[model samples]
Target chain A: SQELEQSPQSLIVQEGKNLTINCTSSKTLYGLYWYKQKYGEGLIFLMMLQKGGEEKSHEKITAKLDEKKQQSSLHITASQPSHAGIYLCGADRSASKIIFGSGTRLSIRP
Target chain B: GAGVSQSPSNKVTEKGKDVELRCDPISGHTALYWYRQRLGQGLEFLIYFQGNSAPDKSGLPSDRFSAERTGESVSTLTIQRTQQEDSAVYLCASSPVGTDTQYFGPGTRLTVL
Candidate 1:
């Protein structure tokens, strides 16, 4: 079975600072996804990366897949309170199943 | 367009009881999936359904957990003889036939006492 590991299990940063969260997979990744959840709410899709060396950004957040396709990183520039949430990385284990990382809890101090 | 929707946002049941959670996928989505998220943990895949083909039940934790999808519209996950370990948020996701990006529902929080 494939597994995903996220670094910095929990992080606290100033509202204006920048931070990066990393996700590494034990197996070669074919498809990787990033999602954000506010406390107990549902997950909100952020972005997806399929090809190696691919990078995508939305607003102030950016995600990049490594050339080896086994690691991905999400960077937040000038984080805000709205960016405080649980960030999870999911890897496609098969066509229909996705295995998720334990998740990184992010908090922003105003 | 509406995203995936789930019913009974929260559920409370006793041990040894049976519970059913419902999910309504987006219109025209041919793939549906069920997952469980425990407290402070990531999502765990439970089952997957694609169109009329047999569902992939390899992720189901045990025989007590089962799910069914009617056509490509609605899916129901049932837990029989639930235990305390069964307490978690049950989530459902759906996507188009050719895509792997899934949209998730609000999820049903189940508590077993």
Candidate 2:
């Protein structure tokens, strides 16, 4: 019954390595957002893309929405240990509702 | 100096007890939403409040769950006769009208015994 699907449910990378996480939706997304959460903490907004073929970046993290509007990717450049956490992708069909992906657990070792 | 705020960061209650969780959205935010996240699961939409006309309660799992937002500012989610399965981290988020970015509050962790 889950609509948003994310790959590599869990990932581990060495410091300075790059990593990517992908999210695909069964239904078209009107708005796609990326968030990061530390264990037991609230989610921090990373980026939001509303238009297809749109891309945005924050710090070392960059996110892109494909032209199909049903898929998105989040890439981290030169990953750091601090970047380790749970990454979540949420699709909002409208401002009223959002469906979340089963987060990607990222761990970085130095 | 202000963001969405939730109360009683942790709550542990016995089965069949009722519980109320509170959220105070940022000033001037017109859109508010509630979500629940179970262990090892993604967040699930619970309810939404937009300017107090009427809330979208489509996500409520059962009649035992209900929520109310007062005057477009604060919201309270009430669970009547909570069951053991009603344990999760309940998150509250607020956004201004027509915006996609939502600011989330540290959720309330509810544990039913």
Docking quality tier of candidate 1? incorrect
- Each prediction's TM-score against the native? 0.55, 0.55
**Model 2 agreement with the true structure over B27-80: per-residue lDDT tens digits:** 998888888866544566788787866887888899999999988789999999
The TM-scores, chain A only, for the candidates as listed are 0.96, 0.95
Tens-digit lDDT track for model 1 on A28-93?
A: 997788888663234667888888999999999999999999999999999999999889898766
Q: How many Å off is the CA of B109 in candidate 1?
A: 0.2
Number of clashing residue pairs, candidate 1: 0
- Tens-place lDDT per residue, model 1, B4-60, is 899888899999999999999999999888888665445667888889999988789
Residue pairs clashing in model 1 are none
| lDDT top scorer | 1
Q: lDDT for every model?
A: 0.85, 0.83
**iRMSD per prediction, in order:** 12.8, 12.6
